[model samples]
Target: MNKDDAELARFNALARDFWDPKGPMKPLHMLNPLRIDWIENQYGSLVDAEVLDIGCGGGLAAEAMAARGAVVTGLDGADKLLKAAQLHADDHQIQVDYQLGMAEDWAAANPGRYELVTCLEMLEHVPDPESVIAAISHALAPGGTAVLSTLNRTARGFLLGIVAAEYLLKWVEPGTHTYRKFIKPSELAEMCRRHGLEIKAVTGVRLNPLRALQPQPFELTQNDLAVNYFMSVRKPL
Candidate 1:
């Protein structure tokens, strides 16, 4: 497995409560709508699109894509998280093909297989993020769009993304992220370019402290890329 075992173990422990709104996965739940909407805006309608979500922990993003009429496949390395995702899908009657595996292997087997590829919040946890980007490039068909989100490697990112989010606010688990693994936007863009993908858009994500009491608190912007951000890329047609 080309994964960090310790990181996988930490996420596995949250499988049981992955879907709870007030639980440790609250940030994901809150940001999901924005993510989905942004994806749709970048790739147009997901209806009938072949979508693959790499590192689809607990299937939050997978289930959402399915609900939007896309044929969704979710790939993850965590067995317990996959089980929780399966159980949740069964309960909701959502048709998401959840698989347990690594993105590189899956990409090798199914090259150019999907119309849209999503690898949100997965890069920072992986052992080699560039390899994952390569896999994403391989799995996407000509003109296909790939969307990714991650924290930037910066002091602001550490202050807000890790310290405030993990320690002060208690928004996510304490060890949810490591500052060193966070990839800067320029580095991410360069990686995507090397993999034959064109950058379409970039957006910064920020949580509104005033909306802390609300179900959704995060917003996407064009100005700030110092911390958490999203990038959209497309394979050449």
Candidate 2:
């Protein structure tokens, strides 16, 4: 199989475990609340908004958005993951339209449609990030907001996200990430600018254990130290 097919197969294998609260993705489970807060605060309100979750693995983020009263559509390229997302949504009785297709391709088919577009933790995995950014820009309605979260390309990011998170803690599957694919904040901001989206807010993600411990935070202030950066951009009105 080719590289894309191989990657899809690997992700499909992990689809079932992605939403298990007590499974290997404890970190994702723990950070879900925080991510929801971030997304909500950045985008203002999702109530009655038409939202799109690109690469909505297991429909976690989409479900969260739906809980906030948004009409959500979860899109993923992997068939197994999309099926899992659909099943999860069905079991929860939350309505989310899960579609199987590449983000760029899907966006191209339905342009200027969504009020809020979220492409979290997925851009770096694509072969052409610029094209993906352009697609996201096209998919957003005038004055719409798009939030993207991805790893930064730096020594700190590589050491933390890949070396520590993936290799040391075994948080994610081995070979799930590649340092070379990581993108820096400036690169992402510039891409947004080129795609007719203005970068509004850029923040870092912090992970913590639910205990009496200081929060281990990732700061987006310094581009070189930000392991993961969350960006909020908007299409011109």
Candidate 3:
């Protein structure tokens, strides 16, 4: 289990608005559908699949999976965020097992239990991303897919993802991302490689703020990974 105290505290402070589409998590709300579409495209249906969502703040992605017939378990290191997630899940009458724990610890306790593991936008925040991915590998069922998303470490990432997002436009909460912790696609693939997982697909995520219809319009791009991107990794059978 790798917990970043400051990051935990930051999310805890914003727990109350974690589910609010117009609030601190608005960007995620906008990005969720695109994310789900991309993941489902790669892995197909989630019907009746056992899913583990690490760093699942406020249950956005977890609820989406559950709605698509996935038996989901949401995990987070922050107690406050977990409480908010539970409350929101109950409010929506969606069944999700919300737990407070680190990714490494939870994976150790529940090995080979999930057909799908999602650690989106969280690897950078964790103090030890390698440990978390290793745990995910151990926890995942053979041939199961692991979906991960994070910012690439590049000038474009620092410019668009961080500077423009956090300081310039304030689309996300300020200080949401740390440049030093950002991981490029190659680095992430290597992490998965070390855990015996094979990279299946790599897709970048782009957000256009200047669009008139929406402040944040996101799309998946194949040739561009200097900003946000998602990768699907598969464990050999």
Cα deviation of 62, candidate 1, in Å: 0.4
Clashing pairs in 3: none
Q: What's model 1's lDDT at 119?
A: 94
Task: Compute each candidate's TM-score over C-alphas.
Answer: 0.98, 0.90, 0.97
Best by TM-score: 1
Off by over 4 Å in 1: none
lDDT of 3 by residue, 1-237 (tens): 378899999999989988878888877888999898877887889999899999998889999999898999999988999899899889889999999888888888999988999999899998889998999999999999999999999999999978888877677888999999999888999999999999999999877556624845887889888899999999899
Q: Output the worst ten-in-a-row residue range by lDDT, candidate 3.
A: 207-216
lDDT of 2 by residue, 1-237 (tens): 102666678788978897886566555666677677888988888899999898787888999999899999998888888888888888889999888887778888999999999988888787778887888998999999999989889888888788887788677777888899999999999999998999888887644335413333322242332788789999999
Model 3 stretches with alpha carbons more than 4 Å out: 209-216
| Model 1: ten consecutive residues of lowest lDDT | 207-216
**Candidate closer to the true structure by TM-score (higher is better), 2 or 3:** 3
**Top-down TM-score ranking:** 1, 3, 2
lDDT measured at residue 22 in model 3 versus the true structure, 0 to 100: 83
Candidate 2 lowest-lDDT run of ten: 211-220
Residue 186 miss distance in model 3 (angstroms): 0.6
